[model samples]
Target: MSPSTQRITVGELAARFLEQCGVRAAFGVISIHNMPILDAFHTRQKIRFVSARGEAGACNMADAYARVSGTLGVCVTSTGTGCGNAAGAMVEAITAGTPLLHLTGQIESPFLDRDLGYIHEHPAQLAMLKSVGKDAFRIRNPETALATLREAVRLAQTPPCGPVSIEIPIDVQKMKLDLPADLSPLAVPPVQPNLAAVDQLAERLLSAKRPLLWLGGGARGASAAAQRLVKMGWAVVSSVQGRGIVPEDHPASLGSYNLQKPAEEFYETVDALLAVGTRLRSNETLNYKLKLPATRYRIDANALAHNRGYTSELFVHGDAEITLNALADRLEGRMQIDPKLAADVKRARAEAASLVDGTLGQYVKLKNTLAEVVGKNLWWVRDITLSNSMWGNRAPVLDHPRAGVHALGGGIGQGLAMGVGVAVADAEHQLGRRTVSLCGDGGFMLNVGELACAAQEKANVVFLVMNDQRYGVIKNIQDDIYGSRHAYVELHTPDFAQLCASLQVPHFKLADPATTRDTLQKALAHGNGPVVVEVDMNAWGPFAVKFAGPPKKKEEA
Candidate 1:
């Protein structure tokens, strides 16, 4: 065949387009619907495809991969049931605002949107995808497949970024088209700030003595600008997603302890509060009832974010990086910053640490032990569990923006798969970093099959399963608020050692609190592949203070 006759199928176009856009890895479960695209990936051998046990696991893996790698994480799935299976994970990505691309197969063009019974057909699948993600698209014409993919990626990486999905029909995937000459990535223009608005914010903050900066998920890309603000005597506090934006070890960094008594009290004294790219979510703000500084300013790419969470005195519409750098440029050496602000921040941080330390009980040892072993560089991934709620979120203190990954949407059972994604991204970037997924027995069991996937990929991850033989948080809530009448919280505990043996993965059990360090070390030393370290929470006992549920206003409590 002549060179002009060698037309490319949509499957091959997707493969080549992703590679051109710098996508080094993708996660998915292979099925007949998506076999064509997977075949292209296999034939090209450019993007590393991670085969997860389930669609949920695959999407969760992609979410975590984007978080760790700071790239466009990709996931592929079959049509109908398979696409629906990925919705929960897609919601998590949307909540975290991760830049991810989800590609799923669809039924044949002839059978499209028909109510008649057909295999792998979901009537309104595109609507479902749009509901769970930032945006969703369907490739109706084979000729526009590449353009649709490019637009999806552009939207996913745009400011206020989130996951975007594209559904291509199996028949369309097989249709041949002339390859586009240009495969370069789409260019998304930054949301530039209004200089007048930025100047007004700078002027208002110029007289402030105690200025505070609240960083959130949207500010992750502006770490360098945030650091400059810190150097200029701004005290830093972050939401969970914003941890490490200013290096938690910095004396002025509050490190997600924003709602702790010490930090809340400190907020009252702050004369100026500059909230950057944060939603000030209910979880972190006591459902919007927490008192904040009287004078507040907010910068965000999403204009709607201005007055939704906590009303700001001035709202600057722009990307976090651009607005922050512009603010720093205007305020440098001009503001009347307090000389003792750093000391005040240090005192607040110390008090917050003390408050958390008093509630760890025997697990304080576990927290400290893990800190010593994992140090600051290890990638910390967590699910919603008793352990993470207690200490896992703020323990070791991450130093880089990408060093932390967690279910920002408060989902359970995503950590195990997220760990696999983190490990894959680590390998692809040759970062040589180890990942530890902190999960509860209940959540771990939810995605237990993914452990096999981790083992198969030889992912560098340690699954730290905190086994309490129940849904500890639900039980705690029931005890505190429901007259101690436990219902379905208790679960039949599994023998993790036996389970690990079946998967040929190394396992270690830490029943004694004293063995926390040793067990973690041993698991970490199993460097070749995944390892499971089960912390016997039942044997070890309860925390010093019970976290029944999220903190609420005094009236709600």
Candidate 2:
């Protein structure tokens, strides 16, 4: 073919770039402004675009896809309103440090800065996107489109990764471009830690009698190194996002119960703490008031993350995987294992698990039933609800590094959309693995339309809705703070079974905890598409432990 024949439009080149980056799937809604790019994608047929009912759902799906697949999650949306709709999901992705590419379409080049009305125009859209994403860019010229996209992808995938947004004008998308013979995806190099800092961290680990390893989402890639430390008799605790980093079933793993009292007691026994890839966020640290060991050391990709939450005696700036590998290499065969310290870790692990399980009480049956029926290929996803706050976050056993995903930003409606994204990615990547999303009725109602998106795409997701018929957490808060005077918390739910029927999704209601396993089995039997299993929390009775808001005053006590 001639050089002219090899030429392609900017939109076509963008699609080709994504294909080169190994992106097999994307999520978005069709819009007039984005037609050129969508047309190119449709003609190429290289990437499967899962059409979403809303832009928010599309972005959430993309976020979850990145979390599960460890690749750049792609979402396409129109400019202005579509981008605005996607902002909340972008925030969730930012909080989770998910690598996501949000490709959006802007008005034609000629209509750039005019106050004259354009169908989907919003002033300062780039600024709005920057507020939500790690970075935002505009392709002012068709020649720079590919380079802009390359930079966006690189930034999104870089350590301390988050979402990146790029806007292409309609005219720019349509402009024809010469295809470069050597077009290749840009490679962002990983950041390496200072050798002196690594040595200092090793010295700290070698000297401690009772050492603990605290893993966070940033440490997910360092699982092998974390396991080595665990084998070296280091106790392991994880933030919720870091749940599967050490394998929750391991004897030393404390899972996501890091903020509880038993774990707090265990913290007192720790002499040195090796906190890696975690911010030790305020929520996980009991609003930064939870006591930690005196000699704390931190390993993170971002140098600025040091002393953000708790002060660390030493801070090593590098990728978690690299830093942990260095520590493992330096400390191997150099230190003596303390039998008493190992025993203490085992005891602390057991006590923490027992205390959490005991607090679940009646909810334990439901938890066990899900655990028994979910099998090994489970991705435990949850929404922000009373159950998640109480036990759901820490209850499930995740075997793989990316086996658990949730709205770490405390968003409510994202679980359903995220589950769809995860299930879609799982089907394409790890077939037969189930994505089970636990959501409350109130939260479920927030993005309920995404269930249709799941059904439309034939995603293998089972949404287990804990139907308490009210904002359970808010009700508890009101009950504690407002002298049991309930107002506006109760909500009348639609018949979920019928709603599922209308959306052509299989539905199951668990009114009795006794039938939980069987109901889950039956619901999951038809694995052709998404399923909704509603657990009637009211019929199961109140949770064993109640939310009592803040602590009471000493005088009141």
Q: Which candidate has the top score in TM-score?
A: 1
- Model 2 per-residue lDDT at 116: 78
Residues 1-557 of candidate 1 have per-residue lDDT tens digits of 55665688899999999999899999999998888899999999999999999999999999999999989999999999999999999999999999999999999999998788798899999999999998999998778998899999999999789999999999998888888888877998989999999999998988999999999888888999998888888899998888888899998888888988999999989999999989999988999999999989999999888798788889999999989999999999887788889988899988998899899899989988898998887899999998898888887788888888999899899999999999999999988778999999999999999999999999989999999999999999999989999999989977999999999999999999977887888889888889999999879988999998788888978
Can you give the lDDT of residue 305 in candidate 2? 90
Clashes of each: 0, 0
Candidate 1 Cα errors over 4 Å, as ranges:
1-5
Per-model CA lDDT versus the true structure: 0.91, 0.86
Per-residue lDDT of candidate 2, residues 354-437 (tens digit): 877776767888888888888657888888987887778887788788888998998888889989999988977765578899
Q: lDDT value for candidate 1?
A: 0.91
Relative to the unseen true structure, what is the C-alpha lDDT of residue 284 in candidate 1, on a scale of 0 to 100? 88
Instruction: For residue 109, give model 1's deviation from the true position in Å.
Output: 0.9
